[model samples]
Target: MVARIAAPLRRYLDTEAGSAGLLLLATLAALAWANSPWPDSYDRFWHTELSITLDTHTLNLDLKHWVNDGLMVFFFLVVGLEVKRELAMGELTDRRRAAVPLAAALFGLVAPAVLFLAINPSGEAASAWGVVISTDTAFLLGVLALVGSHVPTGLRLFLLTLAVADDIGALTIIALFYTEDLDLVALALAALGIAAMLFLRYLHVWRGPAYFVLAIGVWIAMYESGVHPTLAGVVIAMFTPAYPARREQVEEAERLTRAFRQSPNPEYARAARLSIERSVSLNERMTRLYHPWTSYVIVPIFALANAGVRLDGDTISDASTSPVTIGIVVGLVLGKLLGIWAGAYAAVRCRLGEFAPGITGLGLAAGAALSGIGFTISLFIVDLALDDPQLADEARIGVLAASVLATVLGWGLFRVAQARQGDMPGRPLKLDPPVDPARDHIRGPLDAPLTLVEYGDFECPFCSTATGSVHELQDRLGDRLRYVFRHLPLDVHPHAPLAAEASEAAAAQGKFWEMYDRLYERQDQLTERDLIVHAYELGLDVERFARELVESRYAPVVRDHVISAEASGVGGTPTFFVNGVRHVGPFDAETLAARLLETAPAA
Candidate 1:
């Protein structure tokens, strides 16, 4: 019963947008509760002591500290797993493909620190410069998702890789600069625990409880050794074996499955299940087990604990002129924008890395701007860097404010990009090589102010649906809006090539629109038999139509349409280009009408 309930919950938690929304709500709830009339209760609750006793050794810390130092260990462990996975087989596995984001992250780290130091060169706040260096992957990716589907896949991958690199830098800074007095004996114990973990791995020990015990010992040792215990989580995860289980194990699972099928008994069923389970590696299994927990529960709990800042007048006034606030705002909002773009640009120019497909300069700039939305890691560093409450509040405010602004800027830039996807100077959606009036099938007047070109496949369901919208547009706009049809029969569709040729054959008989409507009306049936029948129904010379189909006389027209579509960056069927500009917005008649009317001649 518990498994049944958890299955659906786990699926919901895996969705990035849903998880991000929950994180945002948690942050807002924290902010609201912290500023409410009973704000003192907020302080009291988090300060409540939590303690664990094991024999003579006892560990005690406040509830907030436990959430940050204890629960966050799992979060970092997930991050470490992702980094290792990427290094082994994902995008970072390619040095050339990885270099762009890596270089961008490198510059992104140094520029923010340099900017923060420039603002607070010698003061007590100078120690907190690390606060501005990290990018929060969750919040940044969330904001990009909010920008909608127009955000390119390449852009998303670039931002993700850049954030992962930034995290590596943040972890290094915490280990080197944030540590206090070191205890050599505790450090030695921590090393021993790590060594034991490795030795167990070497011995092929895959039991969960054994590893859990070793991880706890390492965390305790690191905590006592004056290094952050969370580092132990990352270190342990890095050691996780990335390779899948052996082929022998997989074959054994297959054999067990066959036995289970043959016997239909409990004994065989259990054996089969165990064999299949063992066939999956521990690294893959752990990632699947913990990712949802870290993303939805642990990260949201961390935000609820850390994002509570009193938003009263005194806090606002203090934050306005505070050097720490100023530095963080400048570093994140401006420094990240300039540094990441410049670094990526330099890498591309110097031939260190080439831009991935569909990544334009404008898109890269927008992604660089969004990288400034640093919330979780920024707040974490604020806690470690400043001891004074006032300065901490100031820095938090700046982080929050800058994050909000960066989200707005990123969204706006991408929206503009979507609207202007294929726009060329002095050309709206003009067909390249100019439409051959002698060969093309066009509806409405030739001299119409607006021309809507559709690169369509008759077999495509979407193109069939869009035909109605096109007809509606023509009836509404009359001679003012002209429509042209071009063939873009993708190879995936078995009958689309012949369908395109049949439409062209109809055009040869000066009955293109009638044949076009017939093809769409009977889209499910488009064989040579179907086309010949449609031609007879349209009163075309059956012999001429059959000859046109066999001879393939108008094949170049179809090929030219495909070439034009490719040059204009048309990626799919039913792609509409209006007045020479590719339309990236909605496909509905009202939106298309509004856009078309913009190109209408002055009265």
Candidate 2:
């Protein structure tokens, strides 16, 4: 089922790949230490008492708390960015595009919660209804990835969206359902602090440290205000700039730049210069300053620290009987499958939306079952929601068992479906459907022969080198080599994506080749001004180009490229496909040219 739900993941986590190794190592390490003589040491390492404070102001917690509450905030912040993006442009952008997921997410969340509540109606675990409703996308998907090639792409994407929606709902429940009692005084002070920060934001003052200080106050308020302090992070995250889209700094710069031109005197030039310069500076700071540290480092560290559960001599039966254990186990296992199925079925019945073809109700159910594999986040939630040590231990065991069961069940169900289909032996099954233009080819034209595709990161030396090669090829072949550039910016390479979109915006003016060349030629310099300078250098009507870039005019273009690249199984930088055939091995100018010539028609 994990394989079916994650066709792409299986390849990533298979024996051939290394990601699965890390996952296995983590899981084995946890289980090994739990069953080892040093289980006590492992326990202490995770649960060790820890504290954070400012002389008069203070916060006290264990190592577990720091991971769950402190680090996970960054995780949620990145999630919020994804949510915001989806709402504006991606999967949830339109009601039509969103209906299937909305239906699926509702069922996925509601069913699990209802099931858990039914199983244990009157216990402390009732408060942890959210745990059952949640699924750990990272761990579960990573596991599913162990299933290679047998799964289909549509199913994988469907499950991915389902898990993402599940995450959003799970986060909401944590903030709303499981909070401390409200404290009005502290809450008010926290509110005031947030207001001060927002006021600064309004005044165009976005230095992060002040926001951090204000956020700390908000966390204190939440702790005192009867709400879980973690909610403070969610609340503050909602207000962060997904991209200050309305306040287009590039356009604002141009407004200043234009004002300077219109002014009759030299005074206008100086004033406009300052306006443009100041706006540019702020924009650059905002864009360049904030990186997604939370998702990559913070989340991984949290997983490493908190996910290390120690079972030792504790039998499954002993653990399962506890309310916390029962709650987590039933909630995650039964809750996920039922909730997702019901939500999706109801939507189709009510005409909200239907599942993608080749993705049946059974497939969805299996995917939902896979979602029940909620070890990572569920374990984290257990730390926060239940105070009883015994209860917490129970929750951990339940999480482990339920997550494993869910993975097996999901994988099994998908396999059954595949087998039934495969049994009809007339023809072999196709893994993925052709790209749907409306959905997949967002902003670009689709259907071109010899579709020369380039996968590159804007920041890599190799990619920078290849861009030149691609341009030369495009220029030589012209219409025969339909060049399509996709961004595969590495997690570590931050500036590459922005540079890609800048080139894309230039494409809006039929200057893709020009802008593309400029970026590659000056690979050493990729600052904001340099990006604009390249546009001007390419004679790409700088104001319009930069404005569109700031406004993300090519997001659809970027997204389409992303979808296409995924379909063709392109994972990293500098991958290419000549007419749908992949090329990963590096080749010199002569060898590649020879192959192209062999495939090329008479002049």
Candidate 3:
């Protein structure tokens, strides 16, 4: 389940990291084009008008506006999809887990705006405060990857969560503060379009074309209503559903594929494809489809369209004295660092939430420093807030300078952290807490020379499949190996926690291994009532089992294993620790046997 959840996040980060180079290149190209002899051509090309006409009505925009308002919609859509996913099932699902990042993000927004306003308090410059309020997630993650090769997963997750929340605040500010005069009729029409989309979602309409047409309508209506049309992407994405793959849908896909394999028929093939598509939610599917395009193409194009600023000595000399430039630099680089640090500190001190396992104050501080790299959205708001080319250029320079300085600051802090921690490069991957025969559910000899620990979920299909390999290893190794099983039930598996409790309930009656085997054997039938029935079949005290499950007697025990799993960098089910180190790659019987033999004591 962790693999299922983390896979998308990992992909998202990797894509963002990969695209950072392209984004940088585009920014550099834009600056060069603007500063070169062909600077007039740069402006003229972007200002060339393009129009779409339908009978009596027409929609028109210049090249730069099209890129900013149209192409960037997909970028915001990707952002919206990620935020929705996180809110629904990712790190933000747990309130305790979400509290610190949420606080940090909120403070990150407020402090920057306040600092910007303090410097440019009342006039047009103050209106541009939103420029400092967002962090460029791509650049932030990219820099983190570059500077800290072994940064703790918890810190990365914390920063990701903070970025999501910061985006929400930034988008809200754009909508509420930067919008032009309202067009009531067009706004009403846009509202109706959103309503229609919600209705389609309610009716379980999965057809892409239906949503696509409605999204276009909303975008058009928003464009006419004096609201940023890009927001339509966010609205549409918020209504798109996200969920883990369903077991029944997966099983059906397997059946269809098998049928297709048996007889070469297009009907079976189509059915298999449809079944596979239905197994994953539309939100996940669209994110996978569109995120790469946004990260690799649209965002770079945005940078190219917007990052141009003539960096003449006069412009630089003027910007050095410009309050707008000074405000943005101080707000983003200094304000974000201090604000996020304060918020995280307050949250931890107030006991509102604690950082994830393996995350330290230094790591959090490093992440906060990186948050000051507000390149993408800072330049984005520059266009929206400042009409004068000179002021906009100054703001752009401030944004670029803040990003460079923030990167250096973050790199320095991470180095300091590494040195202070005795040059420990990354989070420890060894088996945390170790195996205790008295507490852990162990099989084979307690004093066995070899130890194999598995952090597993009762309802995880992969874990069930891996049970075969475990059985094989046990048979071959006999008394030479002992296996420890720990519960790490995932949120996707609704019944897994209860099932884990059932095993613990059985353990209270000295049948832990029996119940563990039975749970895996009947993975599909792990309902509360089914668990009670399994207790009966196992010849345990069914009444005590049912009572303990009802009372959640073993929840703490299961939670302890989960905490230990996180501390040990276990991200998925069937995670094995051979001896004291995590096992990578295949977990087949042959692999496990070979690894165990390799780790065995000499002679």
Candidate 4:
């Protein structure tokens, strides 16, 4: 029964729509519950006090506080992990490449707070400036995903980096400006807990339970010290390791897996499992385990608990002229759009950083407008910033209004941009230098009527899946289809270039297809050692293959392929060109066959 329930839940959490849909449902439910006949029950339920006592100390908090201060720590921890991963190994690893989004996030953060402060100059309202500084990552990404596949991956990365930066800015503000009266002893205790965690790390203690205890201790201490306990989540995640599996770790996994496949015994299974577990870092493990929980469960629960604002005539009347409402509405819908666009534009103008290829000025503006769909973090902040019930309700109204407006406006603008771009005359596909039979990797007759050229990365999951479809297409059209493969390794996939290089090295020995088949079959195990093992299985000179790979003997060919791909505007992996024209949509065997047959008469 547990397994049965977990399967569908896991499937639901995997898709962008599933997570977003849950959040939306929760928001609607909250609004309905809040406005229903039994409205006071909404407040009553959330305010029900819960207390924990340890010796002489007792920590008492309402149910809402538990969700905000305790459960939200998990949410913030995931945010921290994403930020660290991006900065360490993802898109923001390069300083120059990182500049555009970092600059945009800075502007995106400051402009809104400044605008909010301007609208609500003084008193209790001014303190709620943090409300406007948030871009709800879930909502923003959901809306973008809903906009369809034309949204460039680079633009998605830009928005992700921008949201992460916004999170950092918001957390900093909360820590610096939002704390109550400080308790020195409790602060010292929190410091001591953090120190203990570092000591455990130095001692090479990887036990989850040990970390949990120390983290809880720190959380309790922070809460007692008048600091928001959720900040501890970010602090702890910042210290988690970021690198991938080490050389020996990968080797061990390969050995164990080989033994398990050969022997099919419990001993081999245990060893292989242990090796596999040891290969990935703690950060990745945590991310894989907890990200879905935070996104689909914790965040939606937070929305359900906090998004229940009683919308009545009095609330509407107050919200219309309320400084908090006006500031947040203006800040999110106007300030974010202008601030992010201006920041990106200025960066490009000043040569600070160039925009991602295929991303235009209008696309950036559309993305900027999308950034204003602030729901989750905006609600979280309003909860923290407002004390008076009326003010809090007004702020909630503002956030909801702004988010709805932003979504509609941003969606309209993006669709318009897509239509405009589509309406322009289509450029003829031009592959430079033509396909050289000697240099290219071919799978079918050279004189085949239709040529399908693929720009692919071996380590990319999509490309690996695409290879299966390409094979199906090959089988379906034995004489009519000619398949050519080119290297276009993406920078985000660390092992992609190496995998491409390995394929090239195999091509040097006339076993390129064998290596290609094995790589895609074992896409999860594309480590260097595994690549060499695959080479050996294909009866290649393993020593020469490894040497050629290390020396990058085929680097020039791979570079040429990448150059050709760029010239043809291939911005992503698994790009397909059929009969010298780019195929714009799905890359499945059925689609390919239909397209081929459709154009066969013309050819």
The clash numbers for all candidates, in the given order, read 6, 16, 0, 0
The lowest-lDDT stretch of 10 consecutive residues in candidate 1 is 1-10
TM-score winner: 3
- List of clashing residue pairs for candidate 4: none
Candidate 1: residue pairs that collide: 428-580, 428-581, 429-579, 429-580, 429-581, 430-580
TM-score of 2: 0.63
Taking the tens digit of each residue's C-alpha lDDT, what string does model 2 give over 1-603?
222211222432232133334544666676777668877777788778887778886678788677777666656655555555445434565576468777788777887777777866876766666667777666656655666544555556667677667767877887777766777898888788778877987987645687778877777676778776666765665565443243365457677778776765688776666555455333223323332354345655665676565564565567856766776677777777877787778888899865554566677777788888886567667766777766666777787788888888888988887788667643232212233444331222354334555667777888777766766765665565555666655656667667877877877787776776677777766776789888887777887876776665665456445444554556567876654466646744444455565655444
Q: What lDDT, from 0 to 1, does candidate 2 have?
A: 0.64
Candidate 3 on 1-603: residue-level lDDT in tens?
A: 223225678788888888888899999999999999989988998999999999999999999999999998999899999989888767777788789999999999999899999999987778889999999999998887787545765677789889999998998998899899999999999999999988987886767899889888999999999998888888878888877666557768889999999997888888888888888888889999999999889999999999888888999999999999999999999999999999988898999997665677888788899999999888889989999888888999999999999899988899888788665545467887788777799999999998999999999999998899999999999999999999988888888888988899999999999999999988999997798899898899887777677555566567567767877878788899999889988999999999998988675
Q: Ranking by TM-score, best first? A: 3, 4, 1, 2
Candidate 1, 106-215: lDDT as tens digits: 99999988999999998679999988888877777677767765665556667877887888888888889998799999989999998998898798676789889999
lDDT of 3 at 61: 95
* Error of model 4, residue 314, in angstroms: 1.1
For all candidates in order, the CA lDDT equals: 0.81, 0.64, 0.87, 0.81
List runs of model 2 lying over 4 Å from the truth: 1-27, 148-153, 243-296, 308-314, 320-327, 416-603
Task: Evaluate candidate 1 by giving its C-alpha RMSD to the native, one decimal.
Answer: 12.9
| Top lDDT model | 3
State the RMSD for candidate 3.
8.3
Worst 10 residues of 3 by lDDT: 1-10
Q: Which portions of model 4 show Cα errors greater than 4 Å?
A: 1-17, 256-272, 425-486, 489-498, 501-603
